[model samples]
Target: MNDLFAPRIAADPSGWNPHLAAVLADLATTDAVIAAQLSKWAHGWGAPFSLGSVPLSAVYATHVAPWNPPEVTLMTAKTILWIATVDDWAERDDAAPRGLDHLQEVAEGKAPDPHSALAGALADIRDTVLGAASSRRRGSLWVKATTALLAGMKFEHVASAQIRDGGPPPALPLYLHHAGQTIGVPLTMATLWASAPQPACDSSLARLQPPLESASQAIRMANDLQSYERERRTGDLNAIALGASPAYLRTQIADQVRHCLEQLRPLLTHPCPDAQALHYCLHFVLRLHQAGDAGHLHEREQQQQEH
Candidate 1:
């Protein structure tokens, strides 16, 4: 992992923004809340494999903070845990399509098996997260984002199967487009919107289109860089496995990060505080992923401690 992303990681402390540092610190303080939520969910769902591997503190610090309302932080934390657990499971298991189908059914408002712990837990998360939306439009947006994430998961399952069957890696453009959705950026954005100070209209969100795409691409590249080795060993389809050299992948990731930051700069000056907060939150997560937490979960606790 270091060999693939050393250059990108080495340039990071300088790229860190001070304004977001305070927000991140505040987020880190939510560790107790996130941990409590995770503990409760673990007791009910039997603990995801990631419970021991990925620090809940680090996840909330990167994914749920800055925009999370104090009242709903616990719900947000649970949602993040659900997303991470489902994502890890899908990536590691060959039978993921079955699980994805179950989750999609639950997300679509189908009654999950009352006896199935995983299905029940997923339904609870879907309801609680989407239920917090202030308006039907925002709720629908959250549902749409979740649907897109599931679609991306199915696409990844197909790509992973192709790789295992000795087919070529997915085309670069195809990977990036699908990876953006698979990485959960859209869902995260929907969460941000749902928790924003005011309802975001289509036009307001449209203004953020460029930065959002840049952020998604940056996240995809960072994830690919950090996961290349493990993904290769696991027969997963990664951007790096598409025959790109380490140096070239590093350059591409750097370029994406720069573009993401550039696109976000103007949004920082937007009249809406939600728009500005969204920009900061997006940058915060991208920086965390670029710093290697997205794939290298073992280091997350240490990194957060140092921060």
Candidate 2:
């Protein structure tokens, strides 16, 4: 947190903040991995995301964990796309099977229902994360996060269905609280902690809980600010779609992000690898919004494959 207040260090590779630029140069290499895996994940997992759309490697992987081994990077990418693909599936077509009904159960090592690519992806991701976790604590955190994420999605899903059927949306306060989980930050962060084995803060899921809450809410609202129109048309749950003014939403985002950073400050003071990774995410997301690339925050917009 003090670093957020301090002047930028001269050593930052990019002129952006330290976390955003620390591994700035290496994101391209990870971009290659995201590309190659997307193709495989496309066919292999029946991924709802397109294989042709290239990912901004920074938003997906490099920004979170450039220091991760390629194998862990693969797992991280899988977890990300899996969550995004399901969210997309839910938004576009509710008639089809979501395959996410038992997401937490599957993530806990149950066999994915046979022939369901979405479930299979979760199973694979879980196996990889468990294998990478050096301690039971990390694995437990991943499961807890996954469970909470599923619960959040379930809450929003019901709200979407209600609105689609002509009912009123969830109350603003409840909607805002659950909205961030639908963006998938908690699950991804926990996965990173387990897979990258962010050694500095693995002792307890409690270590990251406060900042994680702030980051997730900030990210969810960031998307809501920009995607309100599309979401309103689709009858999906969004703060802006529910009549939150852009100005008000922006205030909420700033408050959440500021609170997140302050909570992360104490952890960052030590050599916590998890803090470092999450710090990068917090700043990169805000910068993305500032640059209008925050649409990438939604994940459905990334449609590229590097030649």
- The TM-score leader among the candidates is 2
Candidate 2 lDDT, tens digit per residue, 216-293?
888888778777766666677888777788888778787888898888888878788788778887776655555443
Q: Using lDDT as the measure, which candidate wins?
A: 2
User: lDDT for each of the candidates?
Assistant: 0.67, 0.72
lDDT of 1 by residue, 146-209 (tens): 7778878888888888877877668878877888888766676676566444654444666666
lDDT of 1 at 101: 85
Clash numbers, per candidate: 0, 5
Stretches > 4 Å off in candidate 1: 1-28, 47-49, 57-64, 200-203, 271-273, 293-295, 299-307
Candidate 2: pairs in clash = 1-265, 53-303, 53-304, 54-303, 54-304
lDDT of model 2 at position 23: 59
Mark the 10 consecutive residues where model 2 has the least summed lDDT.
1-10
